[model samples]
Target: MKRSRFTEEQIIGILREQEAGVATSEVCRRHGVSSATFYKWKAKFGGMDVSEARRLKALEDENAKLKRMLADAMLDNVALKDLLGKKVVTPAARREAAAHLRSAYEMSERRACRVLGVDRASVRYQAARPGDGVLRDRLKALVQERRRFGYRRLHVLLRREGHAVNRKRVQRLYREEKLSVRRRGGRKRAMGTRRPLETPLGANQRWSLDFVSDQLTDGRRFRTREALSLVVDTSISGQRLARELDKLIARRSRSAVIVSDNGTEMTSRAILERTNRTGVAWHYVAPGRPQQNGFVESFNGRLRDECLNEEVFASTAGARTVIERSRTDYNHVRPSAHGGLTPEAVRLNLAASRLRNVTSCAGRPLPSAQQIGHQTLGLS
Candidate 1:
């Protein structure tokens, strides 16, 4: 390294020698500083008194130390312009980051929800769906009364009443409100013998029938079978019956075909004669093959799950009341997967998706839909 032109003591000495009138050359040569360097120092220190120079030097030193500290902090990720709004919640930060990432993978919302540990619904967004409070309330009334409408049928009803709505939005809001005619449930199998029928292709084609049994806290038991009469119309879902065994079709034209297994009540010459008397076709699946009657069995399992299973009924009347309430919910409020549309709405908007395998694409038939006596959601 090159030697410095001036030293602290030498600089002071030079200033002192200049004050004493010593030859500048002798002072410069003694200090090992060239004339130019000497003059530069003189100019710097000459006007400022010694105390000011020292104070300025001290300030410079402090500034250099602060700069080094700041640089080190930057390297270690600690340097920040404003510490405000930093991660107040460490765990929440991780969760929010996961939520943002989940927003990116729109294809797999469940996976994203798992990664984020958030409700799948928080990530599976349906865009702005405005509800006309009055309209929705009215619809809710109808749903409460019917309890088994899919969105398509609801949409038609709504249009007739002058409430224009997007069926898809209705489906989303229906789920968010959990106001569908049916309750939700997990996967399960059926009880007893049944058959699986192909998803229907036309309206008024097929209907499913099943009974829901519940026990009262007093140990009294009651049974009521919901017809779950699905009206298929070249679409997966047509309409739901939720019809109790007591209901009679005063207007026989409402149902064209009835499909069921050889249950005692259904096989009783009485029920068979009833269908024959109504001029409706009756189709029965071979025994032990519930898949042949997939539609109603699915409904039954759901009835058990969302209604019978979600809660414990205290009495026969309580079970009946709860089942009736859930029936209305199932018909009108539930979002469905058969078409990624409610069973009611599948006919108009997502009809294309009907019968296209909601549980999988490989088309594996779901387990026997004949769940009875199990806690289920709707129609069971």
Candidate 2:
């Protein structure tokens, strides 16, 4: 792409001299060019005037410009295809993408920004935000203290400790530090028509029972029997289950119906006798349908996720202590799905609602026994 020493007008003038019967040798000698150069010019502009040569030069310039533009458009297309499906919401991410396009596709900065649909100023912007070194160290310490906590829960903890940081900032640092909790793959769900289970109307109306098993550090296994929100650890026997149920009933009101899966511990003679003695109805769900008894199943999932999976119990006593603490936290401290209220809070709220209903009914006249019997028989 070296530029020629002669302009188009000069080259055309020299060619005219050759066409006017001047010797090509004389023309070359006068112009300090070789005969080859003169003949090359003659072949190009032999029948062209200066105006035509100028027009040809302009066309060549325009064609070169168009070629450059087409090449840029093709590079932009390639950059866009490469960036497809990639989330570049942040300025830092866009800057990185711009750099990638420049290195990968040989695109200019302006072209890269245009192709990425980001402003060039944004791509060139330097972040002036303060560093999170201290915050990150504190966050990692909190993570070590509570390894089972996710970013949202950790954000809550940070706020409790009086850290003036945004939740999004914490999330960003959480990702950058690679502190994400590893999750197990999901199991395939059974697909079919599913009937919803009847919801409990009151505290002592219904209860779900389930067992969760885990191992001590010595590899000794233990089983925990969960009754709705209650958790008790014991040996894997129906006698122990009955004893645990008795203790649970002693502390709380006896439920009218107890739901459990078709496990041996649940269907054993000891459990059946205990239920009969307590005048409680024992119900068994279908063999592979754990969802039929979902209350305890959900609790067990949380226990496994937030407690059992996070702790290493050295002994049965240690396991019991940790599990009891986790149960206390779950019932009294941890927020439940009932509008972020804990289980204890929900129980208190339900009790308050029932009291209000009773107080409101206090002024109403009592129904006669015969009327109650008719209502029970669904008579008008």
Alpha-carbon local distance difference test for all models = 0.53, 0.72
Candidate 2 residue runs with Cα over 4 Å from true position? 1-47, 63-90, 99-108, 115-117, 124-135, 159-171, 185-193, 225-236, 352-380
lDDT of 2 by residue, 1-380 (tens): 58898999899888888779998888889989998888888788889988998999899899999999998788678778988888899888899999999999887897788788889998888879888999999999988977777787777668767999878999988998999988755446555555577644445566667778888888877776122333335465788778767876777757778777888888999988887788899888876777676566666676788888888989888877888787777666664444445556666665676687876655554332111111000000
Q: Give the per-residue lDDT of model 1 (tens digit) for 122-229.
A: 445454845567766866776775465666666656765777677876675566567755446554545665433454434434455544455556766554412343
Score residue 221 of candidate 2 by CA lDDT: 79
Each prediction's total of clashing residue pairs, residues at least 3 apart in sequence or on different chains, is 63, 0
TM of each candidate vs. truth: 0.39, 0.69
TM-score of 2: 0.69
Clashes of 2: 0
Q: What RMSD, rounded to one decimal, does every model reach?
A: 14.5, 8.4
Query: Cα deviation in Å at residue 180, candidate 2?
Result: 2.6
**Candidate 2: residue 236 lDDT (0-100):** 59
Cα distance off (Å), candidate 1, residue 326:
3.2
The CA lDDT at 375 in model 1 is 14
Highest TM-score model number: 2
